[model samples]
Target chain A: MPTRNDMLLLTGFVAVVLAAPFLFEPIGAGYPDLLQKFAIFGIFAIGFNILFGLTGYLSFGHAAFLGVGSYTAVWTFKLLSMNPLPAIVLATLFGGLFAALIGFISLRRTGIYFSILTLAFAQMSYNLAYSVLTPITNGETGLQLSQGDPRVLDIAFGRDYGAVLPSSDLFGLEMTGYPGFYFCGAMLIVCFYIALRIFRSPFGMMLRAVKSNQNRMNYTGLNTRPYALTAFIISGMYAGLAGGLLAVTDPLAGAERMQWTASGEVVLMTILGGSGTLLGPVIGAAVIKYFENIFSAFNKSMLGDIFSFLPESLQSGAVSVASLFVGEGWHLTLGAMFVLIVIFLPGGLMEGIRRIGALARRKKPGGGASASTPAE
Target chain B: MASILTVQNVNKRFGGLKALDNVNLEIEAGTVHAIIGPNGAGKSTLLNCFIGRLEPDTGTVIFDGVSLLGIKPHEINQVGVSRVFQTPEVFGNLTLRDNVMIPAFAKRDGSFRINAWKGVKRETDIEAKAMAMLENVGLARKADEIAGQLSRGDKRRLELAMCLVQEPKLLLLDEPTAGMARAETNTTIDLLKKIAETGITMVVIEHDMHVVFSLADRISVLAQGTVIAEDLPERIKGNPKVQEAYLGGAHL
Candidate 1:
């Protein structure tokens, strides 16, 4: 059954996220630095998928909330505690609240206009954070906990939560990066499962109906704007949680976290892997994160060393060609990947997998009236 | 018998054109009423006003003791008035079953929730209801077929099934048999007769006199955005006003 596939996917994801650090320990691949980024970014991209994917509304400024979440979390740390829990929670609440405001206005204009409006608001937020709200935003440097600030919970400001409770257990585990990773990973799994459930729910059907035909939905006696706004706010909260996790893992936040490019990065992740399909964004996140970690780590010199067995004359050219695959020009690869996915693989990897699955079951994609299948 | 839907002195002006001019009519419950008219007679405009798609410049549309003026289209729909537009509105992306399931789902549960997570395949009652509606409209076997791919008659049938699932107190149909073949039209007549036995009120507009003569218990002839004649089939068939309105005798 589809339910089994969903469970298998969820369990496989949790297992991978949890066991990654340990698995990578021997190969020096799963360092805390990289694993934490993947888990958090995965969260951001997945949340973005729920909004842009299901409703067919493409938001160009999602990073605004990510920035808002990080700023809120850092403020929570500065004024309240070094604890990540309250910071993530408060940040998520603000993300939802902020999205509700934006959704209220932006939802009035749909399609490309809605996208442009969200982008403009995000840019506006970025501008304000850089200048007008400098006192709280700390300008371009981003908000950070000051040494002079009194810590109500943790042992003084600069110290970790570990310093306050020497036993190192907040939720019955060592209150360290490991625990944060597990906590975030657990939340990601739960969010994914919830999104899957929502995708299959009647409400999800209405949303698809809205996407397919808004006029008909209205005639069917459903006010569609509120439904869309609800979806936007929920997805926004998920992005905020992802941002909070970033601040939690690193214990520092920056304005660049909310940059327009950061927002585009989530969009890229969702689309490159697949939008509107469960696990699509996760695959996308892994791909992008791999490029960030593994690909960027190589260069002409390192690549030369990687394939030093070639002739001395051919070595340098090979390294340069390989650089196009991994280094400064890796964007070309990403761009190519996106174009190919859009053209040949419109459904992303999910459709390909589905096709293979169908082939395995001795059925070609349905011809005639059954061209489209119910989305998972 | 009391009228289920009452339109009184309704006036709709569209910029430079008077689309509907002081139109007044009453649709009795359990009766199949037909509105026959020539091109631009405002039959479609009147239907739009009744379904709350277009606001009238004056007068009110009273349905089941409720005022339809200023009510949103969906709210009007919930009040038991469903409209089938001139063009078939069967959802292109959904199966015939899914198309029927939409109104059934909306009728059974109030609008907006997390129904996305539930498996619609398991909603036996919804499927049964959709199938039953489909069966009456002669589309039961095409339940799993995509609605957009249905033949003209089947698409109309699907639209009818969609409207029927809502269980409306009154149905407003604008040119329901507009593009159907003669064979399809008779099937439709039979279908409408079958639907009426369930005690639902229906207001149908037709250009085909055979269809009008076959199904309508009462008929109203519209000309230049106003009703020129209203009476039983026998009376309207011989009415001089109706004869003058469709003087070419082409509608027959």
Candidate 2:
């Protein structure tokens, strides 16, 4: 039931995602690892937007589901086969179940109180996974696949890995390098389609109604709790799927994945890209991940080399100043960018794109008629 | 006609000040019953009790043979009651069509359903009905406009369309013409008259005498948490108690 415009948007988005390697090669983000991170986090942010953007419920503990997904996926790998399918499915289910529990309790309150409750629940999960749940989470050492572990499914199928550790695979194709990126990319596309459908569904309207006026919704004979809770669970499953993908790319589950900072990262991604609009979260995720991987890799020598054309004194001074905003200090750049974006483009990158599109249309003669169409 | 709503021994108190002092009333089906009172006369409090917004200290509110007390607001709504707030509480962020379609979906799918997979645009029947309701309220031209951008009177009409789409058995309106200009008020009156002809029961609380007298089949005058007079609209205007409580003995 997607409109022609929606179908065109989907096709354009798919083309760009599939061509990411070629498109990003000149920017040094063409590597499989960063591309995989972009796709995985893109899924996470899209899910988070479903709840936060539509319903105006800000959950600060979504990383708990992500961590749960990682642990579930790792456990699936250790106990069953190295196949990513079972691992991803179980990870998504556990993530949703955990979200149902947390959403049920946290949704009892709203506004700042709801945010704090989610934070508390997440902090509790982080601590439990870091300490008390050592048997399951492996505590400080983290959970990793080992040769000693049982792979019942693989053994039943008569497949064996003698000395070298087996990586996650689909059928016989190893999910690493470009294949890993493609795997995550496929999942991201499917998730985006589902998110798009939900946005155009009756359920999405109800969520928006919840944000608009809860009193009216109740008076209109629509229960807002179930709607909010369903959004929460759906987002949680998305985070879980992202986590499972993370495990597939690199078969390790660490307690740090459940930390509050990780939860905050997704929020920043959503806000930076545009919380409510389709395609914004993916862009935001890519921008943040790009900064984390590429910007952090810069050193003083790299800055000096870039400023080599300047005089000796000017080059040294530039390096000294520029070094503070890169390498380990790359967060300063991100913080400044976030501040500027919030001030100038409060609706995030999407607003900026819309304004530029508007400006371009205004410059073109006879474009006014089509440009005046209302934005959804 | 049989009564659709009955209230007995309803009492509510806000600390020492009584909001409703053992109020009682019955509204027959298919009639426009107007509750007119001065400011702070507990008319809203009484209406709140019927809609499950407030529970009275001692009372039984029977709507269509079902007790309305101790139930949720949505449960009350599900039992065939719909309310339009005094300030026109429509979904401001949604389109007018979406605003009307939400209640239609709620009515068809009960209180909760996960109709997530189907496209909202594909529900052609509901879309047609919602559009027709908007057209009935003379808002068909601005169907795609955001509800928040509407004028005060237009928003009120939009809210009416939203409620009418639900096809509720009873509609409760609070100050349907409170802030409207004279022309808008007349238009609303005409719309209400057309709706009244369709045979749905309505309970309206209004401070506007012109709206009340023009549309009310029966009138109840309340003052300081007590009903002083209840009769046909023309008869209630002559009652000395109603005159004293409402207009301070001024000739009506």
Candidate 3:
């Protein structure tokens, strides 16, 4: 059970997530598709942070769980129904089981060895899903509700499978545009709440201990392995939930989802936003997704339009330079940002924000001796 | 008194080097048993055997009538044997209070417990007990501080608090006062003496004769992977073999 403070934090977080679409409108990212992507990837990053951030065990193969979740959800749609609820449930359960299997083997080693094991497992899964498991995973064409698929529950609901491709839904609520974004957003909030509970619990302390000093923790009378394995499984299940939501929103499960790059994207999100902080990964996900979708669309003409206020010659020069940072070159900007964050804010964006807050507090005229006590 | 820990005919080797050779020890309950020697005396290697960090090739180590040979290090701790490292191994990333609280929680919940849903704030009894231990270590003011930022002496005290919080049956110290100034070493001696008065058995490995003499009730001198002498602190000080192997070389 959450305490009163926990309840309040959850309530506040839910409000922000619910209001995100409207809040993001002025920033040009409020569209349902991008918003949905934000929520789904936010869940992925949060889950990734539970293992990487808290436990300091960086598994470079979380995409395996994500791909597993997507495949399970797609399979559920093909065999059971178009209703996303059951698909999500199965995806989470299967994702946890897969994580447990992988964690049992991979957690035997520490540091880079553990990461390499997870990476190897993810690559194996990707290859299997693409080639050998083509009959089930549908190869490069991806898994979908085909004309001949036996959606037993959908058929019983009086839906015509012989007609057009079925859109995912929550009962009669069509999962697209506003409704779909809200569904994904709600799931993000729920995942965040679970993460919050784990953070405040004794289990979280053990994980931190594992991260801080596993050898010391061993002598302190903690089996450390179980704690790390539990963290890995929980994070894997979170990734799976995100993957399930991806299938729910788009209705396709691809083997590419399990690729190492997909795993790297979530790691980038966690570190860019601040790995250990609660709200850091969510913000990092939002920033990265926004750059990937919105910033990548900026062309020479759009840049020219924004720089029109300057003189004609200066505008042309600025557009050429800015174009290198956006559009097809947006990764340059991302790389530079990553470098700056790593060098200046080793703790990530959260640490930068903390320093800024401290400086501002110190600059306040009323601040005196107590302000000099040093921030924790 | 009954033996709290019994190591019988233990032998360990790394290829050609004998880390411990036919080492036998019987630690009486409720006593401070200090092991002293020069470098390469296998003090740490012998300590490792007790904590399950290293397995003796052929030996029997029984703690409270339970065999500790096959058990893991954490299991040894759960069975009431804890070790303090030479460099003061601690959860440096966590707060001093948390560093102590973790051991208290470990003692209460055994080696492993899934208490993810229960809030740490709700574990008031644990928090209070941890706080009291911090106070006992003279780190009450620094309890909220990050443990990594503490001075060397304080870190040692914090480690002592962490071990004492578990209330272990046997506390093993490996150079507990290593890298300490004269004053800090004296403070640690006093602290160990205070902990000793509680009747908890301690097997301390130290090069610092000052610390050894101040707290040890019985002393064992190890020379070249073997126990050359075992007697009261005064008797071991005068032993000819001990003097040649260790005490004489120390310029004491």
Which one is best on TM-score?
2
Once fitted onto the true fold, the runs of candidate 3 whose alpha carbons sit more than 4 angstroms away are A1-5, A157-162, A309-316, A364-376, B247-252
DockQ values, each candidate: 0.54, 0.87, 0.82
Task: Give lDDT tens digits, candidate 2, residues B172-232.
Answer: 9999998899999999999999999999899999999899999999998888998888999
Task: Evaluate candidate 2 and give its CAPRI docking class based on DockQ.
Answer: high
Task: Mark the regions of model 2 whose C-alpha exceeds 4 Å error after superposition.
Answer: A369-376, B247-252
After superposition, the stretches of candidate 1 with alpha carbons farther than 4 Å from their true spots are A1-5, A22-29, A154-177, A306-314, A363-376, B114-124, B138-145, B181-183, B248-252
lDDT of 3 by residue, A269-365 (tens): 9999999888899989999999898879989999999999999989999999999999999888888998999898988888888898888877787
Candidate 3 chain A: worst 10 consecutive residues by lDDT? A365-374
For candidate 3, the TM-score of chain A alone relative to the native chain A: 0.94
Error of 2 at A267 (Å): 0.5
lDDT of 2 by residue, A20-72 (tens): 99999999999999999999999999999999999999999999999999999
RMSD of 2: 2.1
Winner of 1 and 2 under DockQ: 2
What DockQ score does model 1 reach against the true complex? 0.54
